[model samples]
Target chain A: MSIVVTYNKLVEFGDCDPARIVWFPNYFKWIDAASRNYFTQRGVPPWHATEREFGILGTPVVDTHAQFTNTASYGDVLSIHTRITQWRKTSFVMHYEVMRDHCSIMTCIETRVFAKHVGNTPDSSHHQIKAIPVPEFIKQLCGFSQ
Target chain B: MSIVVTYNKLVEFGDCDPARIVWFPNYFKWIDAASRNYFTQRGVPPWHATEREFGILGTPVVDTHAQFTNTASYGDVLSIHTRITQWRKTSFVMHYEVMRDHCSIMTCIETRVFAKHVGNTPDSSHHQIKAIPVPEFIKQLCGFSQ
Candidate 1:
């Protein structure tokens, strides 16, 4: 079984649109935060720290699919459940489910890559971002053994 | 031919993450705005106006899929090209392509519905949002014939 992390959020007035429902894009924002929180809760170093210790800058999403099941408004307390579903050589898949209390509000699946900085120098501003193999330490930190 | 609308945006510093690259969620934000801009440019009335005239609050996305091919940074001006690819009974599909000059940055496809307010009263805050059939006038305005 994979480890799951739940990230809680409080929907604010600004998170809604004139129609009085949470703007769809705000769901993506919360999902992204949940994605980061998943790593942090798994004892993985922050992106900046990882950049120094390892060559990884961060996990950048390459593709995403989302489905909105229910509408939520301001004052809604939502919880996002995140877990890594698959780990490939250079990419991984993350799944998220947003719940308003017990009701499922939305769901998302993202394909992300561990981005490495490649250039003439480490500090160069013109560095290229490339996908790197899933680090062994990261997989173990996330409680994956296979 | 379908009507295509191009929405231009200037990437601000705040749009980037600590990695100095455009945050993935920001692309969804811009794409949402571009979705509205597409309707506005195609002669569809704004949501507020339609709420009174046609009982439509807005088009809400039910599903979305996005692919990021390249990274973008601050100061990079992006142009989102949006168009309706299909019009169904109660839902429609919108396609968007984000481009920096001649380079393609990302692409997204969204399935959205024209949401109607349904309740005991039109002005009730507790009204339910339901999908409505695509209006004929809206189709004509968007240059769709079938």
Candidate 2:
């Protein structure tokens, strides 16, 4: 099991909809932030630095599933717990649990890939992004064991 | 089969991440809007009006799955096509296809429920929300027929 990193967020008024509950999309935004925070907490360098050294632009979500259990409104504080649950050759699965005062708000599992820019000419329309093999060093840094 | 509703969006500069692609969460935002637009295009009353007449607040997403196929950047115009694929007793499934120039960007399917406030006192702490039976009028408006 990988280490769990907690990311805290304060629900802002703008994050709510006319129904006065937190808009569901805001939960996804926080989940994405928590995803990156997991790497930052694990001493993984920022994506720009990794791009420069390893040609990894960033990890991008390819597939995601989320379940919302409890509704929360503005003025609530949420803690998103995130961790990598599985690592594949070119992708990994991340799980997140969002809680408000220990009450479960939502849970999500996402498959993400380590992406790198492909093609020689960056300006070319065919210059697309492609998933690369999971680097050993990054796996080790994130407490993954073979 | 329900009629498909198309919702258009112009990607803003702030909607992109440092990697210059549209952030994943923004996709969810558009999907949600498309969900609402589907009802509006079908001539269903807004949530506020439904709340007054039938105690229906709105449909809230309970479960969702999304797949990202391609990356999009700022200044791109996206068209999201939404429709109800399944109508359960208290919950329904909404499907969305996001496209840029007919090129698939992402697709999402979400399960949502018709929600109503469950208590008499609006200020009560236990005044929680609960799923209600799918309003027949709503189903009819959206072209669902038994």
Candidate 3:
């Protein structure tokens, strides 16, 4: 399945720095929000809810890179494109491209790995933890398994 | 004089996915916060205020890259180190390293260019805008000029 989502955002004042250009870090925040929205549109509940229900942890990002091709100013309409580039047994990768007026302005690639939630514990060694396979439903949704 | 500031953060619940580790995008957020705080400690008001007084726009990021060396869980105490790396005519760079328990967990570098903020009218263009020089106060603080 080809999963693609587009979001049009006007650079808000909070999103810009003193220079009135969109803050660099805020771009990543927008991309992350768009990624979550994409999953929500696919009929998958938010990742946190999914984790709590199934005891399936999320894959935290282990690596990330971004390149800015053009400067975006306040009120610029940014179109964000997110797509899954790799889905493995224990890890997955996503690619994002932000464009303005159909021209590419930024790109990013992120890699994440599965992890288990250990409950609150004072001792670092005794925290509850376990590694489990990707859930069948999610694997199917992600097109990794039939 | 070298300036160093440490920020204590409770990894927000929203910062983690099912993986139980800090999300990649949140790393940028944390680093950005720390960097801003560093500036605050140096007596350079927040970027927003600086912009208003000097008519000097902040630099726009041209690139960012990060490597996650270790996994950081929720409620972890993360210490971020930020230092100015390059001070150029119309741009500057910052390097950041995130640590937990004395172990380096992440590193990031960002390059930003100083530019003038033209209005958001349809006729506005980046070309028509100009590059403003770094303010004299900032230059002194950054040790670029005394």
Candidate 4:
């Protein structure tokens, strides 16, 4: 288990749909931000720094499951609690719970991989990214005792 | 088997992140649109029309699972293919595939319910949304034989 990190977000007007409720996709956006906050709160450097130091470009989500428990709308203050529940060689599971005033709003789990750009085809402008092992130094930085 | 309907979208600049790639959550937004398109393509009315006719609000997402296969950036033209894979008493499952030309980008399945508003408390401004039985007329409109 990793340290719990919380990210607070204010639901904006644009985040709502014609139904006047927070669109389900916006929950995933907050979950993604909360995911990064977990690392930042643990003193892990930003992706650019990690890329320069360890060649790890960023963590890319491979699989995600989200459950919507309640509806929300703009002007609502939501708190996202995030943590890494499991760590593997190349992937980790991030769990997020979005709450509004002690009410459960949504919950999500994402499986993400630390990735690096691969293939240097001269003709292709975009390079494919491949998953890489979780860097040990970064793991220690996350305070994961192994 | 359900008839497939495709929804086209142009990836906008705002849809991308600092990495210049389309943020993953945007894919869900497109999936939601594609889900609605599946109904429209089958001659089903919009939610507002349905609400007026049947007191049904809209399909509310309860669960979703997504897998990201490839990365896409701004200015990319993408197609989302969606269809209802199964129908239950009060819920249905939608399957979506996001394709950028010939490449597979991401795929998702969502479980959603036909919902309606319930309860109007004098003190509480918010009302709870509850799932209702899948309307037979709506199912027929979606081209479901049974």
| Candidate 1 residue runs with Cα over 4 Å from true position | A120-127, B120-127
TM-score, predicted candidate 1 vs. hidden true structure: 0.94
B121 Cα displacement, candidate 1 (Å): 9.9
- Write one digit per residue (lDDT tens) for candidate 2, span B49-141: 999999898889999999999988777899998989999988999999999897999999999999997774856543368899998988999
Q: lDDT tens digits, residues A19-138, model 1?
A: 888988899889989999999999998998999988789999999999998888888899999999999999999999999889999999999999987664855443358999999999
Candidate 2 Cα errors over 4 Å, as ranges: A119-127, B120-127
Which is better, 1 or 4, measured by TM-score?
1
In candidate 1, what are the lDDT values of residues B92-135, reduced to their tens digit? Answer: 99999999999999999999999986674755443358899988
Interface RMSD of each: 1.7, 2.2, 3.7, 1.5
Where is model 4 chain B poorest over a 10-residue stretch in terms of lDDT? Answer: B119-128
Please give the TM-score for the first chain of candidate 1.
0.93
Measured against the true chain A, the candidates' chain A TM-scores are 0.93, 0.94, 0.82, 0.95
DockQ of each: 0.66, 0.63, 0.40, 0.66
* Best candidate (score: lDDT): 1
Tens digits of per-residue lDDT, candidate 3, B40-96, equal 776776656766776555555667878887767777778888877777777677788
Q: Chain B alone, model 4: TM-score?
A: 0.95
Model 2 interface CAPRI class: medium
Best by TM-score: 1
Pull out the clashing pairs in model 2.
Answer: none
Arranged by lDDT with the best first, the candidates are 1, 2, 4, 3
Which 10 consecutive residues of model 4 chain A have the lowest summed lDDT? A119-128
Q: Could you tell me how far off, in angstroms, the CA of residue B11 lies in candidate 1 after the best superposition?
A: 0.8
